[model samples]
Target: MKKTINAPKAPAAVGPYVHAVEANGLIFTSGQIGLIPETGELQNGIEAQTHQVFKNLQAVLEAAGSDLDHAVKTSVFIDDINDFAKVNEIYAEYFTGDTPARSCVEVAKLPKGALVEIEVIAVKKEA
Candidate 1:
């Protein structure tokens, strides 16, 4: 059985999609932009947005009974490839242990004009 996740601590979905879903021991998350949960506003700049993206991912992962440490893969999308270095620096701060496999690409745009968006695949923590 698959379980859907809707994280209250993360920003609400801007579209008709849930935050994540769990099936077969794996949790797959929807892409998360830097929309602030409390305010529903996009964070400013690449750096701030990158950090906020991680915060949103953390909330969704936690809601799915996992954390960054258990992540198996990640996909990052950025509005500009030039911001890769800044985004990588912030990304490093979050996945410091047993980092997951990742792919990043520059997209022409994202929902709500976000600077960055991230989604994850992780194993549920052992209970």
Candidate 2:
């Protein structure tokens, strides 16, 4: 069975999709941008946006009963490839242990022209 995940502490979805979905002990997160949950504001700059993206991803993971440590893979999208190093620095602050495999690429654009976006796949911890 599959269950949709939504976090009240995270920004609402811009489209129809939920924050994440869980099925077969795995959580698949939708791409998260830098939107703030409280005001629905997009944070400014690559550094701030990257931090916010991870915060959004963390909320979705928590909603799905998973976390950064449980992540098996992730995909990061950035408006500029030049911001990769900065994003990496922020990413490391979150995925500090047993880091998940990841792919990051420069995209033509992002929703709201966000500087960075991230989506993750994580396994539920064994009971």
Candidate 3:
């Protein structure tokens, strides 16, 4: 009925939350930041950080037996609205073909002063 998704390839949750949770045919993921899973190091800048965020998201999705291509919705949080364009560029690299519906907004700050964070929802398709 329900399942928890965990991935050693993604950063551990900062709080008491699963990286992703699946119920029925859908998976809901927690917000992912730019922290590298191996070292827990935050990435350098907007470009690098955004890339890392997507990587983290991908890992969680994979753990849930889903992927970005299966995403139906996503929410992106940015520390600076100015970085919107750059983040979009990096984000598009992953979600370009049949991009999931998304909502991106600027926030005053994020946990650990990270530049960007993303949360996603995906559906597992039957073969």
Candidate 4:
């Protein structure tokens, strides 16, 4: 069975997509920008924006009953590659383990002109 995850603590999707979907023990989360859920405002700077994106991802994963520690993979899209190191620094704070497979790329743009966006795939732990 497939399950959809939603959380009020994360920014609402600007497009027609669920925050996350879980099926057969795997959870796939949609890309998260730096929009603050309650204010619908984007965070400031690459450092702050990256932190917000991670926070958003964390919230969605929690809603799906998973977590960053369970993430098997992550994909990050940044508007500028120049900010890669800064983003990576913030990302490392959340993924402090052997670390998950990851891909980072520079894109021409992102929704709401966000500086960065992130998505993850995680496995549900056995009870």
Best-fitting candidate, measured by TM-score? 1
Clashes of 2: 0
User: Candidate 2 on 1-127: residue-level lDDT in tens?
Assistant: 9998889878999998999999999999999999999999999899988888888888888888888889999999998999888999989898886898999999999998888999999999776
Give the number of the best model, judged by lDDT: 1
Which candidate, 3 or 4, would have the higher lDDT against the true structure?
4
Q: What is the lDDT of residue 63 in candidate 3?
A: 82
What C-alpha lDDT do the candidate models reach, one value each?
Answer: 0.95, 0.90, 0.92, 0.92
For 27-88, candidate 4 gives per-residue lDDT tens digits of: 99999999999899999889999899989998998888888999999999999999998998
Model 3, position 116: C-alpha lDDT score: 96
Candidates in order, TM-scores: namely 0.98, 0.96, 0.96, 0.96
Task: Report the lDDT of model 2 for residue 76.
Answer: 94
Displacement of residue 25 (Cα, Å) in model 4 is 0.5
Worst 10 residues of 4 by lDDT: 89-98
Ranking by lDDT: 1, 4, 3, 2
Select the stronger candidate by TM-score from 1 and 2. 1
Residue pairs in candidate 3 whose N, alpha carbon or C atoms collide under 3 angstroms: none
Per-model RMSD to reference: 0.6, 0.9, 1.0, 0.9
lDDT by residue for model 1 over 62-104, one digit each (tens)? 9999999999999999999999999999999998978999999
Number of clashing pairs per prediction, in order: 0, 0, 0, 0
Decoy 4 TM-score against native: 0.96
